[model samples]
Target: MRKEETVDYHIKVVWHAISRMYNQGGAMKGITASSGFVLLNIDQDEGTPATKIAPLLGMESRSLTRMLKTMEETGLIYRERDTEDKRSVRIYLTEAGKKQRDFSRKAVIFFNDKVREAVSPKKLEAFFDVMTTIDNVIEENKNLDQKIQLIENE
Candidate 1:
């Protein structure tokens, strides 16, 4: 099959386009797309567990560690030891971080609103349903590569 006809290709293309747009928006606010995403994932009031942020954002631990370091140095976030779990930490946004987080939220809302205006609600629902099915299939086929190799050898 042609690369363009594949689901993965389309998903990747769309993600790249969206990432570029978000990065541009983030640049204007003195942050990168990655940093902006981290800001958005952080909780405003209670603070989020440092460990939880990576999984919630689907980010690599090392990447997040670097960003968190930068954010801390820049006074955008502060970390506190969890009271119940001394070894665990929670991340809280500084005032500057809250402002940046607001910007990220606004950007997301604007983009989603525009998409909602352009696409019918039914189509959007169907798209989400299809994506959920795709995710489920991948999860169920975690050993797909090994299975494929065995079949090829047979």
Candidate 2:
């Protein structure tokens, strides 16, 4: 296969692996693919705002609000008015949420260990570098949509 084809195939494989790991619950049932889980893992203690999490998760604020509300209803997380800024709401994991976070951490570790066992350290390092480069390029190109729209109006 060509280099580009190889890259595309590998990207798809990686995406599938991540989707399977997150979307498919292992021992725990009822857990679904959610930005809330990722946010909980990243900010176990720190309370993050809904606006802040939306950008980080590459989701719209409205979508995030709905997700948060669902998670809150599930008793996974809770929101409160920020002490410093009453207008801003901050999110934190409840006791149940913390247990879910722990389960997520263990599942991630297991999946990562399996991947590590399959790939050599050198290959893994190179893969990490390539993924980082791809992330950077995507972030840089995010503004291209606006540029293209501006040119189209000319």
Q: Write the per-residue lDDT of candidate 1 for residues 114-133, one digit (tens) a residue.
A: 99999999999999999999
Q: What lDDT score is found at residue 110 in candidate 2?
A: 81
Which residue ranges in model 2 land beyond 4 Å of their true spot?
Answer: 1-9, 146-154
List of clashing residue pairs for candidate 1: none
Residue 146 displacement (Å), model 2 = 5.8
Model 2 TM: 0.78
Q: What is the TM-score of each candidate against the true structure?
A: 0.91, 0.78
Model 1 / residue 92 / CA error / Å: 0.6
Model 2 lDDT per residue over 38-129, tens place:
54544777778766887776677788778888888888888889899999988888887777877777777787899999999999999889
| RMSD of candidate 2 to true structure, Å | 3.5
Measured on C-alpha atoms, candidate 2 has an lDDT of: 0.76
